[model samples]
Target: MDKKLIEELKLKLLEEKKDLEKILKGFAKKDPHTPGGWRANVPKYDGGHMEEESDEVEHYQNLLSQEASLENRLKEIEEALDKIQTGKYGICENCGKEIEIGRLKTYPAAKTCLRCK
Candidate 1:
C-alpha cells in the first residue's frame, strides 16, 4: 500500500475512534477496570412510576446495544492501525491476498477482501 494512502486511512480511523468514544460517553460510562469496555447508565427507579421506569429500561438497553457495536468497530479500527504500523495492512486475513485499494479506502478497518468476506 502507498504510504500516503495508509496515512490517510490512519487519519480516518483516528477520527472515527474519537467520534465513537464521544458518542459512547453520552449515555454509557467507560468501565474503569476493563479496557475498551462500556456500561450503560442505569437510571434509578426510586419507586417511580412503573410505566416511566419501563421506558427508561428500554432506553438503557438500546444505548447498551449501540455502545457494544461502536466498541467493536473501534477495536477493529485499532487493529487495522496496528497492522499498518507493522507493515501488514491491506492483506486479507482469510486468504492472505492483497486487499483492493478502493475497498480499503471505503472501509479502513476491513479485515478481509470482498471475495473472502
Candidate 2:
C-alpha cells in the first residue's frame, strides 16, 4: 500500500479504536486482572424482584455479547495498526497477498483479503 493510504488507514483505525473503547466503557468495566479484557456491568436489582432481576440478567447477557464483539474488533484494529508500523499492513493473513485498497478503505481493521475472506 502507498504511504499516504497507509497513513489514512492508520488514522481511521485509531479513531475506531477510540470509539469502541468509549462505547465499551459505558456498560463494561475493564478487567484489571486480565489485560485487554472487559466484563459487562450487571445491574443489581433491589428486593429480589424476580421479573426485574430476570430482565437485568437478560440485559447483561446482551451487553456481554456486544462487549465481546467490540473488544475483538478493537484488538483487530490494534493489530492492524501494529502491522502498519511494521510495514506489513494490507497483507492477507491467509495467503500473504496484498489486500485490495478499496476493501481496506472500507475496513481498516481487516486482516484478510477478499479472496482469503
The lDDT leader among the candidates is: 2
**Global lDDT of each candidate:** 0.88, 0.89
Which stretches of model 2 miss by more than 4 angstroms? none
Per-residue CA lDDT of model 1 for 44-105, tens digit only, reads 78888889889988987887778779889989988998998899999999999999888998
Candidate 1 clashing pairs, residues 3+ apart or interchain: none
TM-score of each: 0.92, 0.93
Clash number by candidate, in order: 0, 0
* Residue-wise C-alpha lDDT for candidate 2, range 1-117, written one tens digit per residue: 699999998999999999999999998888867556888887877868788888888988898789889989988998998999899999999999999999999998988999989
Candidate 2 lDDT (Cα, whole model)? 0.89
